[model samples]
Target chain A: MKLTILGCYSATPRTDTNPTSQVLEINNHMFLIDCGEGTQVELRRNKIKFARIKHIFISHLHGDHFFGLVGLISTFRLLTRETELHIYCPKGLKEVITLQMKLADSWTNYQLIFHELTSTESELIFEDDKVQVFTIPLDHRVYTNGFLFKEKAGDRHLDMDAVLNANINVAYYRKLKQGYDVVNEDGVLIDNNKVTTDPNPPKSYAFCSDTAYNEAIIPIIKGVDVLYHESTFLDQHASLAPKTKHSTAKEAATIAKKAKVKTLVLGHFSTRYDNLNDFKSEAQTVFESVELADDGKTFNFD
Target chain B: MKLTILGCYSATPRTDTNPTSQVLEINNHMFLIDCGEGTQVELRRNKIKFARIKHIFISHLHGDHFFGLVGLISTFRLLTRETELHIYCPKGLKEVITLQMKLADSWTNYQLIFHELTSTESELIFEDDKVQVFTIPLDHRVYTNGFLFKEKAGDRHLDMDAVLNANINVAYYRKLKQGYDVVNEDGVLIDNNKVTTDPNPPKSYAFCSDTAYNEAIIPIIKGVDVLYHESTFLDQHASLAPKTKHSTAKEAATIAKKAKVKTLVLGHFSTRYDNLNDFKSEAQTVFESVELADDGKTFNFD
Candidate 1:
């Protein structure tokens, strides 16, 4: 799995830093997170294939979080895309987007579907053969939710030589790979553990942003491999963070530590400070494995 | 009066060429016309003082025409503007901007006024002491209207020598400048025309974009000093012009000729043509004074 940081600023888009948005790639799927203003331009700059993006998750209704969404959708229509497009966002998004489309009398030819997420619970929103997506309810000023992407454990690795030495039928190799023991034609029993190795452990990633420090989401992202949390402010601005329902770097690190995530990626730095080294250093104090997210940096999980 | 072509290339916003948008300065007022995507960055690139812009005019509801409006508005709010903002757009624009504001819960301290236009006939939408703005009803798929900004004829310019020779009192100097000649202290009668001349001919500029080659607006914008018209396609795509409700360079020049506009500035070129010499040559066939609008090029009428 690989994740790319397209934009990670807070409050507004500046000449230097952008607002909240990122792209997470799990196997063959490309999922867009947050989608702030100017995201399409950033996507083009990063050389990401925007058409390959099939799913988009919007954390909240903030303009910095999803203002470029209308433009992106309009561009997709102009490109003559026929593939189905899925947008997971709050309920009022349909009214906002559809109104513009109605006024312009332009409609997309593709299957533009909206999976409205209003429930404040860990409900599974998407599931496929290899991946599953669940909502991690968060505390914020508005209707906001985080996403947890988990890759399901796959089939076991089979030792073909061991299976053949046990006199098992060649047709039963598929069953052994599925962690099942098979009986041989010679009335010999083959042990599954002897022939098959355990499956690779599944990896998971969780995304949280534009929300205050909340421990309620910890249970949903308990065993995540990597958690990207928004650190809009530092400890010095902690007073303003709660009033605005945004988290500071130290608060984000504390949440990540309490969630017991393997690693933490901090982003969404406020524009007040020119330097960002303080954010990384503050988060690293609580979370041992912490990295600051940049505009175009890509992270790979092995 | 001066006009600056910020961007004019049609279709999607590429790295080199931008979509439709421009800036016009008339009588000490900066008017932002049609904010395409990345317009603020373009404004910064051109070194145009954004704070001087108190009015923004959107031609239509097309994505390329006003996709950058929201971002520009947000940036102004971030800058903590104390000046009131006025947007003259289609009727549906209020809902779109208000919805985004509602979601973010960030209202501007300065008053934001929206003058929605829905008329099919020409009508004055804005008028100050020096300039008047009128909407030229357009024929398109959506509710569209072009703007005609005309610097109202001011009081006659006072010829200093003529005024001194007429022996007009200093208190009546204002009245003399307004072309009302008064009797001198010597009881000599002075003609108003002899004392003053026309006030710089009152320059005018008309911005017509994203519309077909309709002759109805010719009478509305007749005898304008400079006319910035959209020429989305060349003569080769003339057949697509009327059908799409767009214009060719030749068509725009023809309209300029019919309206007797002083100078014609052709812009909003289609992205299909690599070379723009054909548009200039085609427009020259119908109008003698014609120039292609290049991004960042400024035209001064003095």
Candidate 2:
């Protein structure tokens, strides 16, 4: 699995800094999360193929999170895209986008579908053979949901030497990989565990941003391989953090430690601070594995 | 008068090229015209003072012309701006912008005013003591208008030598500048024309973009100091010009020549052409003193 940070700042987008947006690639699926302003330009700068983004997930209706969505959709239309696009966002987003399209009198040539989300409970939003996505209800001023992407468990790996010793026929390899016991050529019963070992463990990633420090989501995102949490401010501005429905670096680290995630990535920094090293230092006090996410940064997990 | 080209291209904004937007500074007023997507970032890159941009003029409801407006307004609010902002555009723009603001639940602290324009005739849209702006009705896919900024005639310059020779009192100098024949101490009737020359000739700039070859506006913008006309295509694709409601380079030059403007600026070139010099060469065939408008290029008129 790989993740690319298209933008990782909070509030307004500056010349050097962008707002919240990222791309997560797992199980051959490229899922776009929280398209901020100027995301299309960032996608081009990063050389990511625009057509690969079939599904876009918006956390909220704030300008910083979903303002770029309409432009991106318009660009896709301009590019003469034929593939259908899916948008999973709050209920109000459909009206906002369709109104602009009506004004311009320019509708997409491709099919455009919208999945409006309104549930406050943690629910599974999407599932396929290879991956599953669930919503992590977050604490924020507005209705917001953080997405968790988990790879589905695969079939068992066959041990070639053990299968050869068991005198298993080559035609029965598929059954062994499927973890089923089969009879050998001599009518001897062979156990599946003797010829096959377990497959690699599935990995999962959780993305949470523009939210306050809430312990309620920790149980849902527990034991994730990587957790991206918003750390908009440092401890010095701790008083302003909760008031603004944001989290400080120390608070994010505390959540990471309590959730027992394998790795923690702190991002969505406030533009007021100039130094970013302090965020990592503060997060490291509680979480041993901490990384800082910046614009154009990419993280890889195996 | 100083004009800064923030973006000068047609249709969608790309990584290297931007859509239509410019900043015209005349008579100590900074007027932002046609804010396209990514315009706020371009303004920051140009190092323009955000507080000075009190008025924004949108040409049409097309996303390329006014998509960046809401983001800019939101940024002002985030910056704690208390200054009022004025937006002048087509009739439908107010509803589109206000709807987004309502959905976000974040209203500006400052007063936001909207002036919707629906006239098909050339009419005065804005005016002050020092400058006046009129709408140059344009032909396009939607209801669009190009802006014409003109500096009002200033106070007559006082010829100090001529004034003293006429024995005019210092207190009455103001009357002379106002073009009044004042009574001298010697009771001699002195002509005001003999003492003062005409103030710098009133300079005007006409911006006509995203329009087809329409000669009806030639009489309105006749003999202006500078004329910016859109040349979205070359002679090779002249057939596509009228169908798209755009103009060719030759068509733009023909208008400039017929209007007898002092200088002509050709911009809004389509992305299909790789070489821009062809546009200049093609335009010069019909008119002289043709300049190209490019992103970040500034033109100063004295």
Candidate 3:
């Protein structure tokens, strides 16, 4: 799995810092998350192909979170994209986008599908053979949802030498990989464990942003391989976190520690703080594994 | 008068080139023209203060022309701006912007006033003591209007020595600057020309973009000091100009020559061309004075 941070700063895009936008490449799927203003330019700057973004997930209706959505949609139409694009966002986003498109009179030639999420409970929103995505309900000023992307375990690897030694027919190899015992060519029953090894462990990533210090999401994102949480403020501005429905660095680290995530990626930093290392040091005080997210940063998980 | 080109490309914004947006500073007023995506960042790159932009003029409803307005508006709110912002755009833009704000539940603390223009004829959209802005209706796929920023003639320069020689009272200085024949301190009628010289000729700038090769706007922008016109294609792709409701570099030059504009500034270049000098050369063929508009390029008319 590969994750690219197109933008990570908060509260309006600046010349050097972008608001919020990321690209996650998992199991041949490139998912765009929280397209803030200037996100399209950031994507271009990062050299991410626009066509690869088949699914877009917006956390909330905040301008910093999803203002670039309409521009991206319009760009897709201008590029004459033919593939269907899916948008998973809050309830009212569809109306907003539709109205803009209606006013511009530039409808997309491709299928533009909107999956509005209004449920307060955590639920599965998307699933395929190799990947599953669920909504992690978050507490924010508006109706918001973070997304959890989990990869499904692959089939077991075949022990070629062991299978040949056991005189297992090639047709029975499929059953062996499926964790089943099958009859060999000699009509002898063979154990699956003897011919095949276990598959690689699946990985999971959780993205949560623009939320207060709510423990309710810790359960949903528990034990995630990588957890990207918004740390819009530091200890000095802790009082403003709750009032603004944002999380401080220590608060995000606490949530990551409680959730037992393998890695905590801190992002959505407020532009007021000039030193991002402060957030890293603060988060590390509570969580041992903490990484700072900056614009154009990339992380690869194996 | 100073004009800063934040973005001057056509269609979708890319990593290096922006779609359409510029800042025109005339007579102390900073007017934003055609705010495309990433305009706020461009504004920052250009070192333009957000508070100085009190008015924004959008050429049309095309995504490339005004996609950045909403984000800029939202940023102003985040910055706690209390000044009133006036937006002059085509009809239906207000609904589009209002709906997005409603969905986000982020109403601006500053008053956002929209002047929706549905006029097909050239009309005055904004006026002040120092500057006057008029719409130059252009033919395009959608309803569009270019803007003409004309600096009002300044007070006449007083011939200090001549004023003293004529024995004009100091109290009549204001009247003398206004080109009135005021009575001198000795009760002698003074000729206005004898004491004061004519004011500097008012500078005018016409911005026409995303338009076809229509001569209808020639009369509206005729003999302007500077004319920034859309030149989306070179002569190689001249055939596609009218079909796409755009103009070629040669066509823009032709219009500039016919309108007797002092300097023709070509912009809104298609991303297909790698060399921008070709646009300048192509335009210079028909017009003697041709300047190319580029991102981050600034033009000053003194």
Task: Residues A116-166, candidate 3: write the lDDT tens digits.
Answer: 998999999889999999999988888999999999998999999999999
What TM-score quantifies how close candidate 2 is to the native fold? Answer: 0.97
lDDT (0 to 1) per candidate: 0.87, 0.92, 0.93
- Report the CAPRI category for model 2: medium
Question: How far out, in Å, is residue B100 in model 3?
Answer: 1.5
Whose DockQ is greatest here? 3
Ranking by TM-score: 3, 2, 1
- lDDT string for model 1 (A44-144, tens) is 88888878999999988877889879888988898898899999998889888898898888999999999998898889999998899999888888889
Q: Each candidate's interface RMSD, rounded to one decimal?
A: 1.7, 0.9, 1.0
In model 3, the runs with Cα more than 4 Å from the true position are none
Docking class of 3: high
Highest lDDT: which candidate?
3
RMSD of each: 2.3, 1.6, 1.1
Off by over 4 Å in 2: A161-174, A184-189
The 10 consecutive residues of candidate 1 chain B with the worst lDDT sum are B10-19
What is the C-alpha DockQ of each candidate? 0.54, 0.76, 0.83
Give candidate 1's root-mean-square deviation (CA, Å).
2.3
